[model samples]
Target: MSTTTPPTHPQRAGLHRILIVGGGAGGLELATRLANTVGRRGLSEVTLVDRYPTHFWKPLLHEAASGHRDPASHHIEYAALARRHGFHFVQGELEALDRSECLATVGPILDLNGNDVLPRRLLRYDSLVLAVGSVTNFFNVPGAERYALPLENVKHAEEFRQKLLTACIRANHLREAGAALPEPTVNINVIGAGATGVELSAALRNAINLLSTYRLNSLEPERDVRVRLIEGGPRILPALDQRVSAQTHARLAGLHVDVLTATPVSEVRADSIVTVTGTELASDITVWAAGVAGPPLLKALDGVELNRQGQVLVDKTLQTLSDPRIFAFGDCAACPSSIVGVFLPPRAQVAHQQAVYLSQSFLRRLTGKRVDRFTFRDAGTVVSLGRAGALYQGDFGLGLRSLIVGGRAASGLYAFVYRRHLFALAGLTRMAIETVSQWLRARIRPSIKLH
Candidate 1:
C-alpha cells in the first residue's frame, strides 16, 4: 500500500502535462505524434500509461492465434517507442481517478511470484485522455468465462495457438498408438461471425493444412480437423455490405469451414457447446469473439457518462460530457458520427482517424487556434479470408454507391491497412527497413510456428 510519487523533469517545469491512459492503437499513435511535435520543442510534457509492456496491432491477433504470424516479431516495446518518440512511458493498470485533483492512481506492479515490484503511484495531469480499449463480453452465457478463450490481446492469442497445437499433437499421438475413440476428430468452435471470428476460422484452415503438409500431425486436416463458425445473426459480417458478406461466406464455405448462422450458443462446456435450439456441438476448443465492452475501469471513473456497453460518452470533439479537460476515443469511447447521426463503429480505422484528429486538435489548442469537430468519413470495409482471399466493399465516391472487389486485389488492399499503420508509427525510412527485413526473414523462417 506504499505511495510512490512520479519523477519530475526540471526542464519541463511549468509545461502542461498531457497524460494518456491506455497504449492501444489510438493512444500510442497520439502519444507519438504529440511527442514528436509538442514534447520535442518542450511545449508540453506527454506521458503514456499502459498495463502491457509491448503492443501488437489488434487486427493481427487472429493471425497470431492461427500461428501464421508470431506476435513477438510484430510487437514493439513501449519503453523503446517512448524513447524514440521523446515521450514518457508508465507501465501500470489504472486503479482510480480523482477528477477534481486531476490525478490518476495506478495500481502496484507485482512479479510472477506475487512479490511487490513497484508500489502504487499517482500521476498528475492538466489534460487527460482515455483510450483504454474494450474487453470480451460473454453476455453472461453459462460456463463461457470458465471454458472459452477470448482473443482480445496477444496473450490470449498465444494461449489459443498453444492449445490448438496441443490438441492436434495429442490427437495424432493417439492415432499412432492405434487407439479408437468415439469421436476421432479435433473440433474447434468459434463463436460470433464478425471480422475476428471469420478471419480466425479462415486462418485456422490454412494452419491445419500446413500442419498436415509438413507431416507434423497424423490426422488428416481436411477430414479430421473441424472448424465451426457460429453466428447468432442471419448472416456473417452483418455490418458490411450484403454483397461483401455473401462473397466472404462463399469463400469460407469453399475452405470447408462450417458456418452455422441463426444459431445462438446458450452455454459452453469443457468439451462441447450447447445451442439455443437444443443441439449439442463437439468443441475441443472454444473461442469467443462475439462482442466487446469497455474495460471495467471506465465504469469506475466518477462523473464520466457511460453507454450501455460501458463505453465513455463523448461529444463530437471527443471530449467527455462530464469534464472538458478529459477526452476519450478509440473502442472505449462512444463518439457520435455527427454526419450520419450514429455512434462510430469500433474498428481500427476509426481509432486511427481519431488519433490523427486528436493530434491536430492538440496542436491547434497550443497555438490558440480554433479546434474543429471530428467528422468520420466512410472508407469502406475489408475482411481477410486467409489463403482464399479477401472481400472489399466501400463507396469509392462521396456518395452511397456501393463498390465490391474480391480475390488478390482485395487482399492487397486489406494488407495495405496494416502497412499504413506501420508507416504512421515509424517514418518512411524505418518503415522501409522494416518491410525489407520482414521480406528477408520470411525467406529463411518457416511459414507457421510449430511450437
Candidate 2:
C-alpha cells in the first residue's frame, strides 16, 4: 500500500492512522466508536475530517428547510464531539486524492470575502475511509440547478427557509394592499415523492398553517398556500412498501398537500415547472429532492471503482475493490447486498449498520482475527408525515413478512429511530437530557422558526 507522512501533522511511529473523510452519520458514528474503543486504548489514531464544523441529522433537513426545527439547538459541534470522544477533528473540504502516495489534499479554507483563511494541507493515513455522502442530482434538466433549491446541507436548508419566509411575507403584503399580485396564492412545487420530498411537503404545510395561525402572514394556509408534490414514479415512496406509501399519501392528503404522481418534471423555470406531458405548474418556490448522486470528488478519485451513480463500489466488507486499505460506506458507497442481488439501499439505517460493522471489523483486524462479511438486517422503514403522524412498515424482528401501522403509534416508532441514533452517539444520560431540553423548548418557544 502507498505510504507517506502527513505534511502538516506527521504521523507518529507504530500507531495506525485511521483518517475518515466526511462527518456524516456513518463517518461520525464510526469515528466515535473507534475513538471510545481502539483510539482510547492507543491501538490506533482516529481523525475525522469534514467541511462543516457541526453535524445535524440529514433526515431532519426537511424540518430545517420548513423552519419547523431550529438547527442551532440540534447540531453537534465536531470539535466538541472530538474532545468528548477520543478522536481528532479536522475541518476542511477534500480537494484531491493521490492513491499511490497515500495522500489526501484538503483545499484551502476561505472566508466569506474570498480571503484565504488556511492553506492547503495534506493528510496521510494508513487506512482511509471516504463517507463524503451524496448531493442532489438534477438529471440534466434545463435551468434546474439554477432555479430549484436543494436541501442537501445546513446552509441550503437555511437558505430555503429564508426564501420561504421572504416569499410568504411578500405574498402577504400584496394581499394586504389589494395589489394585482402575480398569482392569487403562494405556490410551492416539490419535485420527488421520496421520503425527503414527502416529509418536506408535509412539514411545509404544517409550517404554513402555523404561520397563518399566528397571523405572521396574510396568506390563508388552506386557501392561499398551495403545496404540490410532483413525482415521476408510479407512486410516492416507491422504495417503501405499498401499504406505507398509501398511508403516507392519505396523511398528506389530509394535510391539504397535493400529491401528483407519474408526472415527471421536464424543466424547472424560475417561476414554474414543466412536466414531460407538456403541462406547466405555477411555482413561487421549487425544491428539488428527486434523486441523489455521490459527491463530485468521488468520480475524480483515481483507481476507485464507482457505480453508474458515482458511488464508490465496495464489497460486502465495505472495502474498496481497488484498495483494501481504503473503505467507504453511507450514501457514498455502493455496497452489494448478501440477501438480494442488488446493492444496498442508501438509507440512514444502512449507514448505521455499516458503521457498527466497520467499528468491529477494525477491532478484529487489529487483533489479527478473521473479519466476517457484513450482513444487513432488514429493520423495516418509517415515514414521518408531520403533525398528521407517521407510517411504520417493518417486521420488527418477529420473523414476519411485514407489519404496517400509522398515526400515533407509527409516529412513536419513527421517533424511536432518531432516538436510537442519539443513543449511539451519546449515552443514555446525554440523550435523556437532550430529549427533555427539546421538550421544554417546545413548550416555551414558537413551534416554527420565524426568523
Give the per-residue lDDT digits (tens) of candidate 1, residues 1-451.
4566674333356688899999998999999999988787777899999999999999999999999998888888899989999899988998888999988998878988776687788888888999999999999999999999999898899999999999888877877888884453899999999999999999999998887777555677766789999999999999988887888888898999999999999999999999999899999999999999999999788899999999999999999999999999999999987545578889999999999999889888887899999988768888998889888888766666588988888999998998888888888888888878888887898889888
RMSD per prediction, one decimal? 1.5, 2.8
lDDT (CA) for every model shown?
0.89, 0.88
**What would you estimate as the lDDT of candidate 1?**
0.89
Stretches of candidate 1 off by over 4 Å are: 6-11, 182-184, 339-341, 396-400
Summed backbone clashes in each candidate are 0, 0
Q: Write the per-residue lDDT of candidate 2 for residues 246-280, one digit (tens) a residue.
A: 88888899999999999998999989999999999
Q: Assess the local accuracy of residue 291 in candidate 1 as a C-alpha lDDT between 0 and 100.
A: 94
The alpha-carbon lDDT assigned to residue 266 of candidate 2 equals 90
Deviation from native of the Cα of residue 21 in model 1, angstroms: 0.6
Model 2: CA > 4 A from native: 1-6, 180-184, 339-341, 395-401
